[model samples]
Target: MTLLYEPERFKDESRTKRSKRQLLLTKAEEIFRTQGIASTSMIDIAKIAGVERRTLYNYYNNKEEMAIDIQIEYLRNYGATVEFKINHDLDYTKQLESYCDTYIKRFLNNKNYIIFITQFDYHFRHFSMDDNLDRYHKIMKDRNMTNNPAMEIIALICKQKELNVDDQLIRKFFFTLHHCILGVAQRVIFRESVFIEEQDYSSEDIQILIPILVNGIVSTLPSYQK
Candidate 1:
């Protein structure tokens, strides 16, 4: 049976088609996980996805493009699963705590993603990519992050928690979070920093470590006007 086209269901045809393409990317990922990329072929993904080789080609020019697509999907999944959480309904400290706790947990769960992500053909293309592709996406996201519904709520938090704080620091703090993730991923890939499997580590250790890091930064920065 086709994974996407259920026997009985109706929805937006365009959305269904988009999902069908995404399903192919997931199938491609599973194949990579099971057989390893070196042994996997485009034919293997096509067979796994129940799509013809020609159909796969329509979405991606070849395996390199397909690999990039799978990495993109992985990053999107992580963002959806682990990205920031801000609750305007809650008071500032409580909401910040919730967001910090959730983001750290998400990061902890994603420890192994760096290993696979580094293998993608063009995962770091943002800094290296031609302006035509990367710039547009960055600009769109930057605008959204500053003005989106979520940020509007976060703005409320800023007003409540750091009533006298500079708004630029609020933005810079979020940028620091992004930098931390990139730093962590880099160390994970290089096997440079503290690691879970090294000499001694546990989930509890990480739980403790994250809160210390979060609260330390929040406290020392003097950003919290209260």
Candidate 2:
């Protein structure tokens, strides 16, 4: 007699494995934020995650790989949320506002992630030469071409308004918007003295800042002026 296998059992096992992996990644992220990546060992992550050292290695080969995975996961989740907000807003200007508002709120709410992103260049250097790291970065860059919310917003404005502006100019406009958001987010995250004298900035401050930069961009667009 031949034995048979159930597909449902295999599906359940796959889901269980994914849950375990996500749990481990969440625990490791907390440790990375509190202890800093350089000082954190795989042992530390396993201890904090309340899992065996062997089990941790079963999911991630090393701390560097795990950290990169965590960062990529964060980006994927964040991008999806922003895309949802932009997609729902039918008006072009409303979509732009949603983009700015969502980004500001998300960054402000996730201070740890903001801190990680602000120091990403330094942290990434540790694994810069790794093939996996380089390959993942290339893949993400390619993926961003269609999935990027800011780029989609610009394209929508140009298409909906029938603007005759050069493509390069529209790209430059998006770059400016990107820089403005990142610059403010870094300043708010670090509490830079030049941007804010206080130890913190409120959501209200960010709400005010978004419109100013976004409107400035709109004012410069040929479609807006006409």
Candidate 3:
């Protein structure tokens, strides 16, 4: 007797596969955070994920691929959050402030992930940024977009204020702010706060730096006036 195909069964199977994949990813993330990525193996991941070694391999070709997938997922989430914060009816300065503060807070919250990704790349002799940027470019290319989240937000603010600037200038401005934020985050993470004298920098101190950095960058624009 011939059996009829059940679409619901197929849907359920797909959902199960996705659920298992996410579970493995989550377990791998935890192991990477605690034991460090360099020390984590496929067996360790499978044991932590409570899956067979073959099952983990079925979802990912190898551990590096799995780690990259996790990083991409994180970046996508980060981009979405930035887009949500910036895509609002508020004025440009307010939007910029929100963007800056959100970025700082997010990085501070995920400092471990940030450090893990960085160390993973160093251990593997890979540049995770290169991989991340390649994926970012592909997505942007598919969407017929050029600027990243940071660049797009900065451009929006400039356009709203009628600040005339070329793409190159806008890019420079974006990188300037980007590096500033990263520098501040690095300092805080490493317990080497630049401006604050305390060994432990408070969130309030970081909040104060956001507006100062934003205003410093804004003040450099040709259209900006004292």
Candidate 4:
């Protein structure tokens, strides 16, 4: 029995679909980054993508759907980078700092993406965003993407520091840290001078406070001796 190769026509069609989808997302992200998501429409995206309205619809039902997919794509890249940065050789504090550094570097490297996220948070709300996020998480789970990078990093910390605490306790701590870092990064990108001009503190200095806070928390952890 011989295995039959897929026909060239089918291969070409698949490639064309992928190419068009990529073009659609590229154009859509550009519009989203410049014009707020609420201001941008399917027609605008289609026009920028150089595709018919119906063709754009063939890929996504609405801008919300495309936005969710684009977010998932960015997060997947971030997750991969986080996974790569996890070093078992480092001690607990260093590992935690590495995680924070990853976020700071990635956010500073792509201010546009950080700006887009700020816009997205301001514009999207209620049921539609919730439903889309649920769908996005499902896709991530199906693809075996890391569901919680912070959880993974914290677990490593527990191992390296010889800390024995309840899983729930560590989870709560790490999640809080995760959001705290994220919120700080977004603020840094959106209002670079707010900290300095108004608060008399440099944004960089404010960011440094997070690692110091993290170190303080780790020091106080019941199992952490140093």
Candidate 5:
């Protein structure tokens, strides 16, 4: 006779697996924050997690795989918060200002997570990117569009303001300004001087620039009076 399928038993097993995975991630994040992912090892994670090396291997073949999972989860949660804050009905300038404000506010509030992200970006360069495409694919899949959310928002702003900027130019503009902002924030959190003693920048300086930069970009649009 064929055996009966035990759905409840399978569900319990799934929950156990998820719980163990979460425990491992929690321990790994703490260790990665202090030692950096490049300096971290699977053995370190397993030891910190209080589990056998084989247990970690069951969830992830290696540290990079585990780190990728943590990174994706972090991005997904942060993206949800951002999507919730965006007022789609707002005008172009207000919308962009809101987006910038949200980014700065979140970064300030979650300094440790931002630090992890900064370190993760550096560590990610040495690893193969084949398994790292989950976040990108999810973003594309969710939006069902060619451009990323930022690019789409920028394009919308241009259309609303009747700006003559090319789509490629907008893409370039966003990436350039974004990296500048992120780099400044990262340095501030890292407690490094931002090059000007006495008038040296803080996260507050980054905050002040957000509106100025938003307005600066908006004012440059053909429709906005410069």
Candidate 6:
């Protein structure tokens, strides 16, 4: 059976419904990222999107619904970029380089995005920005189009013989990867809070730092099960 997708479902073109959905989503993202989810109201997004308050609700049930949709879109967008780069590059280090560069660049350059994350507190509430993580996980049960961006890249690295790692071990490696990246960034950029007590780490140092961290974590995990 052939799959069918309306031409209007794609990114560009002239379609009011699709366009409004995109506009509403984009506005919600901006509001959430700048003012934070808890602080942002549907009316705020409506004002930003140039739509009526009721129109915002017409698109989303509430702030949580909008937050889930926007956050899910961000994660999927990040994953798609990573997937394209991973599939294009053969060298494992090259893939890792692509992954690391994209990850750091996107987050570090976006200040309002950073403020939202820090304000929402991702560590304490991983589900804060996203209440639909379980839904996403279910979609990714067979490694669907939606999976964590960082994990997607690691899967590509594991495919190469030089990386010499098994698929089963990548999850543990990914957890370490996640915290290492976050910890390094917080240690460098936000020195006023929890980081105030922690030692300072420069971004330059992380280029050398991450490899050591990944290698240690990857090596500690057991080899592929028999």
TM-scores for the candidates: 0.58, 0.71, 0.68, 0.73, 0.71, 0.60
Q: TM-score for model 1?
A: 0.58
lDDT, candidate 2, at 206: 64
Task: Judging by TM-score, tell me the better candidate of 3 and 5.
Answer: 5
Give the TM-score (vs. native) of candidate 3.
Answer: 0.68
All predictions: root-mean-square deviation over Cα? 6.5, 7.4, 7.8, 7.1, 7.6, 7.1
Q: Candidate 4: worst 10 consecutive residues by lDDT? A: 1-10
Ranking by lDDT: 4, 5, 2, 3, 6, 1
Residue-wise lDDT of candidate 6 within 1-226, one digit each (tens)? 1112122224464477667777777777777765767777788989988989988777677777666555445444433234334454366555555566566665565434445445445422743544555665554454453365556666655554345565556765666666677666644554334443454544444566556665654454335423
Error of 5 at 68 (Å): 0.7
| lDDT of model number 6 | 0.57
Query: Candidates sorted by TM-score, descending order?
Result: 4, 5, 2, 3, 6, 1
On TM-score, the candidate that comes out on top is 4
Candidate 1 residue runs with Cα over 4 Å from true position:
1-20, 32-44, 47-52, 71-77, 80-91, 108-118, 121-143, 147-164, 181-197, 202-204, 223-226
Q: After superposition, how far is residue 94 of candidate 4 from its true place, in Å?
A: 3.0
- Cα lDDT of model 1 by residue, 1-226, tens digit: 1123221222444776667766876787666654655567889889999999999887665555555555544555555233555554666555555665675566566654554554443333432343333533553364445643323434565555555556676666666654564555544543524565674544434344445545555565554664
TM-score of 6: 0.60
